[model samples]
Target: MEQIPKIIEKVSPALVSVVLIKPNKEIQEENQEKDGFVELETGSGFFISDSGLIATNRHVVFEVAGDYWVFWNNKKYFAEVLLRDPDNDVAVLKIKNQGKTPFIKLADSTKLQLGESVVAIGNVLGGLQKTVSSGIISGLSREIMAKDESYNKVFELKNMIQTDAAINPGNSGGPLLNLRGEAIGICTATISDYENIGFAIPSLFVSMAVAEIGAKTKK
Candidate 1:
């Protein structure tokens, strides 16, 4: 296997931070409100195609109400949802006016074996950019119940890849890359109050969603 640093260097450009920004209302002179951006949430995403197509978890943008943006290479790009998988906790996005772009190749998740080394990369604590963690696949085909940010909705997530990597809420939608630097899963949830317990959605579903989106766009 190549050095982990080398793999990360090649994949960093394709990684993106997904966020929802709310305009702050600041009444300074009782008439004019200052233009300030308050970030609601900062999740993670990655490029999947040359047309600026990005793959991320649906819950990242689920409650944003269309005010989402992607940060890459020190620039922020407005992003629009192209597709959301109804059967899976996945979503695809399109960067407005963006053409060719860097991307990470999706790998087969079905072949992943327990104890295989992996890396997790994404926004940590909704602000720290590109936080990296390494661990082995702790479990697979895990079925767990998760709650949304509002804590009103409880949903079950199935077929998850459990890892020992240090992941948190902000790491949602980030990539779980194999040693080859190919994306094998998308980070979805982490159990707090517990050490090294995180879960990811396998890449099989994500790759299928991307292909389905591409096919729809060509039509």
Candidate 2:
């Protein structure tokens, strides 16, 4: 396996914290004020292109009624939602790029093998940024029914990459990378009642989404 330090150095810059801000009506009413907003959610993401395209989980940005922001390299920037695939739980964001931004390469997820070494990097618990965890691919093509209590809906995620890596609440939308520092999946969810069983959307679906979005953008 590649040295963890070197892999982190190569891919950490591309990792970003995704923040969702929403109006805090309760707070506004309590303070007898208006225009108050609170952070609704926080997750992780990574830049995929020099053009400032980012890949994350759709659930991270879903049902947010306020502004979206991205933090990276000691800076914060406004982000625009570019694409969302609820079926696959994938979403893409676009941010302003002054120049080229560092990005991680995408691996061919179809070639993934059982028990392969993998690492996950993300903001953990919505506070600890750039947390890293390593594990092996525990399973593949898993079909999971994820229930979102907030929305009162359940989503069926198909062909997911199952890993033993530690994926916490804020780890959603982060990258699940191979030893080569290539993103093989996008960390999406975990069984809240379980341990060391996390799920990610395979990179093949991500690549397809990116290509579909790119094609539409040109039209």
Candidate 3:
């Protein structure tokens, strides 16, 4: 209805597509003749600050020193990792004065209810940019196991949102928005064994982490 246009208008500019170049660990091991090898990785993120602060999943910025880069609007910009908390799968990145930019406002996840209609925006399969998908909140406060035991704290995120929206591989770190276009969650993971099992990091944590990062950066 009228709400759809309103949300998209406010949120679209805040969404950004990110491409990362990570070193290929396997390639480096196999090709000992070369100093290093790298593989390209891409994902999506949303701007949370007008001064160039971005909120994205830790995995989205995955790299080993000198191997990461970011792209938006077809322009490549080098970025510095400001803060990363693998425990929550969250990271804050800074790019020197890319100029004033539109940003997304975070919603209060505590108010989210099951069955509420929501939208997801991300780059799917690293092919398209600013793709939009919609679905209802299928479940809340869900949990999934982690591949690495050390990351259990992050994998145990609470107040998560589940949706049937088609969240593909490159959708990680994108925003799971309410129909109002406010970010209710950060699209994080999915249960691939079944259909439509996408999960997101609730806005509550994203807000807390981003705030802490901002505070720490001041010192």
Quick one: best lDDT, which candidate? Answer: 2
On a 0 to 100 scale, what is the lDDT of residue 163 in model 1? Answer: 98
17-89 per-residue lDDT for model 2 (tens digits): 8888766764455543254666556889999888888999988888655578888878878899988888998
Please provide the root mean square deviation of candidate 1 (C-alpha atoms, Å): 3.2
On a 0 to 100 scale, what is the lDDT of residue 96 in model 2? 91
- Of candidate 1, the 10-residue stretch with the lowest lDDT total is 26-35
Q: Backbone clashes per model, in order?
A: 0, 0, 0
Flag clash pairs in model 3.
none
Q: In terms of lDDT, which candidate is stronger, 1 or 2?
A: 2
The local distance difference test score of each candidate is 0.82, 0.86, 0.73
Instruction: Give me the runs in candidate 1 sitting further than 4 Å from their true place.
Output: 25-37, 124-127
lDDT of 1 by residue, 1-219 (tens): 447788789888898888877666532344432556666667789998878988898888786455788988777888988887644689998897766899989999999999999998875333567778889999999998887664467788889999998776556688899999999999888886889999999999988887887698799
Q: What TM-score would you give candidate 1 relative to the actual structure?
A: 0.87
| Ordering by TM-score | 2, 1, 3
Q: Kindly state the number of residue pairs that clash in model 3.
A: 0
Runs with alpha carbons beyond 4 Å of true place in candidate 2:
23-37, 124-126
lDDT of 2 at 112: 95
